[model samples]
Target chain A: MANDVFAKSLLTRRQALALGASAALAGALPRGALAADEKVTLWHGWTGADNTTALNGVIDTFNKGGKGVTVEPTGYDWDTLFSKWVVSSAGGRAPDLVLFHITELPEFATRKVIRPIDDVVASSGLDLSQVPDAGRTGVTFDGKVYAAPLDVHPLGFYYNVDMVQEAGLDPAKPPKTGEEFLEWAKKLTVKDASGKVTRYGFELPNTWATARWIWFSLMYQNGGTFLDDKGLAAVDSEASQKALQYLVDLINVHGVTNPEVGGNKGEDAFASKQVAMKFIGPWEVNLRMAQKMNFMTAQLPVFGAKPAVWANSHCMAVSKQPNEDKLAADGTFMKWFFDNFAAPATTVGIIPQSKAVRENAAFTGTEQYKYFKSFVDDLPNIVYEPLIPQYLSVFSFDKPTPLVTNLQAALSGSKPVPDALKAMKEGLDAQLKKG
Target chain B: MTSVASQPAGRSKARRASAQEGGAVRSGMTLAAYLFLSPYLALFIAFMLLPTLAAVGISFMRWDILGTPEFIGLDNYRQIFADPLFLTAIKNTFYFVFLTAIPMVVLGLALAMLLDQKLKGTAFVRTVVFLPYVVMVSTVGILWGWLFDKGTGLVNYYLTAIGIEPIAWLKDPHWSMPALAITTVWWTVNTNMIIFLAALQDISEELHDAATLDGAGPWQRFVYITLPLLRPAMALVTALTIINGWRVFGQAYVMTQGGPEASTFVIVQYIYLTAFQNFEMGPAAAAGVVLLLITLVFSLAQMKLMKAI
Candidate 1:
């Protein structure tokens, strides 16, 4: 009878162990095989030191909140990320979220690679009014919000204080008008005994993308339009011609900048004190700070009838999700992303699109922020790249964009401005037709 | 009589058995060889042949990568012919080939002849000459770009020191092609030199002795004997140089980016831009097909000429 009882006890013990094993597996499933947390993948092209740090901080904070959503971020260079996005979208393997330039929103939206986020915005009760007018317009297409505006970076004046002081100009007050700018440039320019320019007073980028942006800003400041009523090329208009002439004169006539060292070299010249002033995006603030260079920011001098600067925004967009659950998770993440937009703006040295962020002490306390306050006050005058889907094909530096090619020829003094402008119009029209 | 018939039947059965055993062994060997080759064959079909065939099909469609491809039927080809940039690209490609190929052949032969002489450090000389060929094209391009920079370049500084004004080697449209050609020749001449050196080594030394005895001068001996024997190597090198010249992309892409005004824009750059940047797969495929045909024609013509020479 004792042997029988012992066998029964052994059987009961085995059964209990089996039940415990199953229960333990069920308990571990949430952390392992059957993760209950929603996985959100984000693809971006933010490789700048500060930009990456800011992005990682936002992601880390979100992940640590234990919101049942894990964010996976992938970073690529700008060109590579764009190509990957294209291929992935076509292959139906796109990430849950993507960060793109506001300029690219129209194309992405029209191609259906990204979904409209109107419902998410309304559900989250997010105030869209905080976004700058230009940022809002940039991310909107066909009466719908396609992306959440993150930050606006505009072309502004960056000058070396030492260089300015050496040129006999007050470092505190920079050139505010076209005539004063020209006079200061002439005074600051230095030449060696061989008549070669050793130090340029002002530097303009020779590359197509940057040169085109500067040209566009100048045109807008002069009340010029890139497209007519029918959305056709209007590069031959009088205002555009004047802008082109002004750019040409900077190199060929005024001789303040050298055409040979025009692209990235011009930016380097400013950093290395080879030039007194340069017009570049606001991101240069952090870059110069990292270099430990003494530089200051100011609004671009009024070279035309009005004050205008070229600006673009980086925006957050949701890719086409596979299911309602994923979509809701993406929407939740995007809402949180915009709510905490100030983190990136303060860390990355970009002007905040959100009014609340702009007013936040985190942004207003920085010396760079104080210097860029004038640019912020001039926000209403900023001009954006055209929102047309064909804009990239017309202006991309990677491809042979006719406008850029012709502009290069003109800027390099290879062709007359009128002839280049005519060619640019013709080429732009052809490209538009092809599209 | 029964024994004789049985003997013949037994021989026939032995022959049949031997033939069956040999056939089985041969079949088994072939199966094993195929198994070994299957991996390479699978990769080639998947990566090369399939993509090429797909490209041909895609050339007939108007696909912008984002949307489904719509069959357009030769419109891409028609557009390429009418496009001025395509024409310019073709012209530039031809110019590059013309400028680079002949110099590579002549310089390669000259260098090989010099290096073939019994001299100290021939091994070192060979390694030095072939070094650029192994260096990465992008690295060479960047190094040369700095060397040719307008303001602070070593080349410009030397030129200015010599009382010649600094030339805008990369900025000027006319000079950009020549600059690129120089870089290409410097990078590629080693391959041809190695081939020529091998061919020179293979030529019998007794012929030169005999020619010397026959009152032939060094130049005459080279022209009569060495040149004729080196024809095969020259033919191969000429074809390779021409193909390499036509396939030039990296130097121009990294150094000048087909500027100051698309002056260095070659056919391959046009195709790359069309496909990746513009996302026009059809036009890019059309450009690729055209480039392939052009390269094939040039190679065949050069081969025939080399054979005749």
Candidate 2:
């Protein structure tokens, strides 16, 4: 009897509302209060234990909150995700949301596959004031924001505190200047009876991603630029040569480190404590902590010229959708992502780019948090690789050959500094032309 | 008159029945036959012909991923000649081909000859010998990298035990190519060994017996009869091994990543880096066209020699 009465009332109300547009408008006025069911598929390149913990934390928070939005995350390895994204973009099957390296956004922005988030940012009234200035502009292409900042990962010096103490050096007073660092390295070098290096002072991974960063950081610290104003290869300058020559001398003249460790199993050597120092990114600190190694982080040593670092950022962006249905879901999902997911992910040590969250009192009073916050502070002084479609070419595995060959030649006492730099210049020029 | 009319009627009816039977037999070619062959033809046209033609067409245009392709006929080709990396890649490719192919053929043939004798546990030996070929190329490459690791590798450990300094197998420019060659030999010798073994079994025992009766030595028999009979198989194996060696990528890619100063960087690896990493499809396509021509020339030469042999 009661149900019949309610049904009759509902029918009369609906009929009355349909009879008047004004009544319908009043009924639909509170759209924001009546949250719509939204679902989004987030594609990312973090799959392993790290991603598991981080992703689950964020998802659980979003589910518990009465936000009426659902986020489904799919994870793949970096290379696999990149290739899949390319194929999906061409096939018009892109995911609602994606996480990509900031360096890669320029190419996609050129193709217009990413939905520019400026209007979204504007309409949402997101306050981007406290986010690092460098992180903000790293994702910008042609004065347009293509991606929302996620995190900045910069290379920093990682030292074994135990080894530093054992070498009779002050662990708290870590090397602050270039000369001091050289002295510390000399003290840390341990040799066997046959003059073979038993424990190296420092081990630098010789891949382009790593070795080039080391060279670039040193060059920048010495007030050098990799490219000139016109964006030509300018690595043959005196500052670059000095920076590269220091690396060569560290291996050959100093003989404090083995050249073998540079290319083959350098990370293993660092992990195994065969090397006392390694210049790596903040991510390695997380890895080392997971491995239960007693390590401490410090900024890159000062060279008395400039204080700059090499860094890259992971940016989140909305992919282009083929229809309005997906576009609406994508918008809702992006809003929910920064409002909710960004908080806990930053809690787990991923540098959150939200102005509100990074400055939250929640992140301010923790010991582990202190380690990463310093990195975030220094991120503004860093530089990202220039945005070019062929940007990866100038810094690819093959492109490093001329540089590595020259370094090796110089170390082996086969070539002078001028000749080595000249060879690299010619090789880079040829590659740029052919490219 | 009645007998003649009956005979003509009988013969006409018989001819009509035979014509009906022939028409039924001719109806056997149905749509299913075409359907059965469609899959293979579709694959061939889509994956082989279309991409091949597209690559050739794209060789004349400058295309990056973002922009539209602009036609610049023969510019990519001109750049190829002017490019020093292309020439270096070609040299590296030939070096790889010679270094990998010679040892692979010789070692595979030797293993086959050794196993062909009536020895105990021959089947197990053959299976064990062919195991590496069954392994994935990337796995083999990584395994070789581990085996030749300078500091902690078993090879270096043994060398140190025998009072020798550890060699930087993949990290030194001089030894990097050799390390890659060793890995290639390990990856490929098993396939060549199987081919040689099959060919060895097919050789006539009567000729060997006659040669033995004529007091020919083992070396003499091998040189004269066995090798001559194996010439055709040898040519085919050499052609395949040469092609495989020139296209050596998985080893260099997985092990050193064409590193230690690009000593192990071959043409295919260079082309892959150019096309995918650089995203310069036009020049990469042109480089591929050059590689195709080189392979065609070499394969034709092999075919001619095989015919002469």
Candidate 3:
């Protein structure tokens, strides 16, 4: 087996072109035989300071677990990672372990690039008691676990305490309704004499991620589903349109926030204090909450319905190896890493998958940790982004998502809410039909 | 031709052994020739040629990345024409080509002419203008994004200084195409200008002097002699720009993101999103085949019109 593994590596360098072609074919096929000691190569889209922190955190735990395995790590940016992953998968040289966006997993799993982990999980007997049930369902595909949950990073509403106070609102207990929030946003929103905005109430993003986040939170709160059980675009209903219209009103008619707020990133605007309040992922907890500026955290504000927040989980999956022994070892490494290592590190800004780590004493004492822990129970209540293979296409190109087309119309008052929703529905239907 | 070919009996034999001196002769294959050509030919076949062939095959089938490709002859192409988005992509691509290519060639030629004269530090001036061409696409896109950023952008700042209201260059559908055109031209003109400059220099000074003596004005000489001679370069640059303009992805990816109401969406960005983002490689491949055919025909037409072939 060792000789076979050695030969595989040697052959890989000698015939790069042939290997690439063969690998692409093999990637989509059933698992082949294994080498005795499999070295699982893990590629992640984490880099820079955060990437270093994540890499060191995972590597330390994996190495210390004493599983008699080796894991090689490579990191690139998000888009590049996807592009490389696809090309590599087609070429048959993909990594053993990969960390992809939760939204992207459905398509990748369908393509059979990553394997199901049900057998590995059941054999390893990893406890699932502490992990959120919502997160588990998010990574599960076709009734099998193809990925292990690392953490759920939900958007936390970070507010400037100074602005909140000046607006006659309690920083401890934020607005409970859309009207109250709007009132406070208006009061906190500062403008110069000529009506040029000196400070914005909220910085909206004209990108898919932001628009989807806002639209989902509101629609869920207003009792709407983005897609029906049949996987059709269902956001054109009255409730959904109303929710979308409210966001449009905030920009065009309400006059509370800058109409051009979606021009740049909302989080940056909030961090720079150009905006008083903004919805941002929990990853920013370390960056903003630790700052000297007086700030407070709250659940995403309620509009019409119950309190529901948007959430996505980061997942760890073993990359498929050519040899069978290596596959088993890769599985063992995956089980060991998820069971032991990934959970604790995730608590810093992420909710861990290990049921044991959820209420661990390590997380119980910190103030921010306590705030984050409160939402752990809300995991089941949290919504997942679209899990379809064509999900990214829908966001990036399908014109229905306000991030691409309706945003300018919404901002410029060229297209009304109904027209935008209609456009979105038509575009989404076409894409879904194409599938 | 026959006499030239007849002189190399011994030379052809040795050249056959060395693989250096024969045009039509089967030379003894040199180890170096094989060594140099092997890697490129292998890569070309594996990456470029095979994929191109595969794309043609895939275009006839119905497949997404996840599932096996089921053959459905011409169905993908038929569906492509039926799909409104693909049609829109075609229109948007042509719109982008016209918006970018025309201004690029005209501005590039004008700039070449302006800098063609005797001037102090002409080399320095040429380098400065062409610098943007060498910068990474991401950097160029991000810089333009910042410069065109609504409210706070330098462009807006200057416009407002003159009492004109700020324009949301990337956020308005009416304005997005124009904004993208301006940016595309700014990043690409330097290369074309350099090419035009070289072509301009190749024009005989004696001809210009003769035309001047005949009392032909600057525009007349340019129209009669310079423009006619520059056609080959112009044709080449225009064809290249058409291809490049159709593949405008990075700018859209970075700046408007095919946004401001799908005003800046181009074919390549659509193809990328379709394949990688959608995991629909079949459609993406089909889109590429369509683009390849269009570009080939257009390029052929260009060559024919310019009589380059």
Candidate 4:
């Protein structure tokens, strides 16, 4: 009887231990009841130091509130992010959220990697009507919104206040017209004994992307369009030719700008006071602020018939998900983000799309608000790139297009303007046909 | 426990058991050898062989990485022939090969001959010459880009200082290719130099001494003895340089971006643009196959020629 009792006790102990171990394991697993706290992964291409800091700050604030949703952010350079996003989407391993250029919406939407956010927007009580028309239009395709636009960043004219004073010009009153701008450029130009320009009067970027933007802006200012009524390339029109000639003349005939100044080199030159004035995007505000340079922003001078500038927006997109709970969580997070993005947008040095955010006293009271206000007021003059899936292929440096290449040739004085435009039109037409 | 005299059959049985045991040990060793090789074999089959086979199959299909691949035989190849950019890429690649290969081989041989002699700082000099080969290609391209910059570049700065006009080394179509070729030769000639140095050391010094006693000049000795013996290494250097020249991408991609008008665009750049940028994987794979066949043909021809010589 004693041995039988001992054996039964041992069996009881083993059974209890096994049950305890299994209970511990069930608690440790990532699924089941514990999965109510879903972690959402967000991938972005914001490499600017200020932009990254602001984004992280927002995420921290959100996470500290003990919300059930946790946002995990991953950052990459623009090119790397784009390629990885494509690969991941194709492999069905896309992140929960992705930030992309508004120009890339059509491509991603057509591929069905990102889903329409109409239901999410409706359920979240988000006011899509409050967003800027350009931003709203940029993210919409086939009558459905594919992304949530955060901001609109456009190119503006930046000038050195000290340089303007030294040139006997009013620092507060920048040139308003093309002729006046030319005179200012001539006066600001400085030359040494050997006739080498020590300080350029005005700088125009010669990089492919910047050059293309400037060209498109000039074309738009002249009341020309990239595509005609039938949606074919009309870049070789008379207005475009005139714009191209004017840009080329700025380099060859006027000689106020350096022909060799291309890419970010011109921006660096302007920052170091080697160039007195430059036409660049609003991102320069952060850079100049960091450098503590005496600089100010103005609307781009009327070079053609109107006051138009090239602009693009960064939009938030949600990758397609099958789980209803996860989708609802993403929608909630996005709604919260839109409601509380003004402070982060200010830190990012961009003009926020929210009308209320733009009019907020906190944003307007900042030192750079004078410039930001000007850009916001000039929103009506914004010209965006063509909203097509092939926009990137035609304009990005990864794929060479005759338009970019020929324009570069004309800018470098290697090919005539007429011939370059002819080639560009033919190439664009062929690319469009292929599509 | 039975004695052999008591049970004679036990001795034969023990022998048979020993033989069987030996056979089992051999099989075990064979299994261990395969286990050791399995890791490498798995990686090779997964990464190299399977991808190659997939590429070959994809060459005949229209794949854009978004949808299912549609088999469209010979269309991709036909498109390649009709494309002018592909033709330009081929022409530029051949031009780059002509510019890079001969100079690399000749300069490498000359440098090797000079450094093979017993001299002070020979090791330091050899290291200095070979140092560039170890640096990354992207770094070399960037360095050369700064050196060739038109406004603030060292080359243009020095030229203007001496009353010479500053040349647009990167911006001008006429000068960009030569500029790129110079940078490439500076970066890669060191590899061939090391190869030539090894071959030079392998040549018997007794032959040189014998030729000297016979009143043969240095040039004649090199032509008759060293040159013939160095033929194998020459063939290798030639083949490698040609292949490397054809594969040029980073230099042009970084420095000029295949401009002032695609003057520096090369074959590999074309393939990359077609594949990733244009998302036309079918034509890109076809271009890759063409490059492979060309390299194979050239390598075989070079080997044959070198053997005959």
Highest TM-score against the true fold, candidate:
1
Q: DockQ-based ranking, best first?
A: 1, 4, 3, 2
RMSD of 2: 8.0
Candidate 2's residue-wise lDDT over A289-335, tens digit each? 77788878787887648788888777788887676466555555556
Q: What would the per-residue lDDT of candidate 1 be over residues A350-377, giving only the tens digit for each residue?
A: 7878888788776787767866676677
Which scores higher on DockQ, 2 or 4? 4
Q: TM-score, each model?
A: 0.86, 0.83, 0.83, 0.86
Docking class of 4: acceptable
lDDT of 3 by residue, B1-309 (tens): 787599679976776666544543434446667878999999999999998999888888776654578988877777668866778778888888878888888999999998898999888999899998888877877787777766557888899899998887776677778888898899899888989999999999999999999999999999999999999899988888878887787877777677666777778877877676666667788899989988888788877877853
Total clashing pairs for each candidate:
1, 0, 14, 0
Task: Tell me the tens digit of each residue's lDDT in model 1 across B1-309.
Answer: 686567777787887898898999999999999999999999999998898788889899999898889999999999898999999899998999999989999999999999999999999999999999998987888888877766667888999899998877877788889999999999989999999999999999999999999999989988999999999999899999988888899998877778768888899999887887678899999988888889899999988877776
Question: Clash pairs of candidate 2?
Answer: none
Sort order, TM-score high to low: 1, 4, 2, 3
Q: Compare the candidates by lDDT and give the number of the best one.
A: 1
lDDT score for residue A377 of model 4 = 70
Model 1 ranges off by over 4 Å: A1-36, A48-54, A124-126, A264-267, A322-324, A346-349, A366-375, B1-40, B109-138, B193-229
lDDT of 4 by residue, A214-265 (tens): 7888899888898888777898898899889988988889888865663522
- Rank by lDDT, highest first: 1, 4, 2, 3
lDDT string for model 2 (B1-309, tens) is 686567777787887898787766555455556778889989999998998889899899998654678999999989877776678778877888878878988998999999998989999999898888779876787677778877667778899999998887877777888888888787779889989999999999999999999999999999999999999889989899877777778887777776766676678877776676656789889988888888888888888988897
A41 Cα displacement, candidate 1 (Å): 1.7
Candidate 2 Cα outliers beyond 4 Å, as residue runs = A1-39, A47-49, A56-84, A124-126, A264-267, A321-325, A339-350, A355-374, A398-415, A423-435, B1-41, B65-68, B117-120, B204-217
> Which 10-residue span in candidate 1 chain A carries the lowest summed lDDT?
A1-10
How many backbone clashes are present in model 4?
Answer: 0
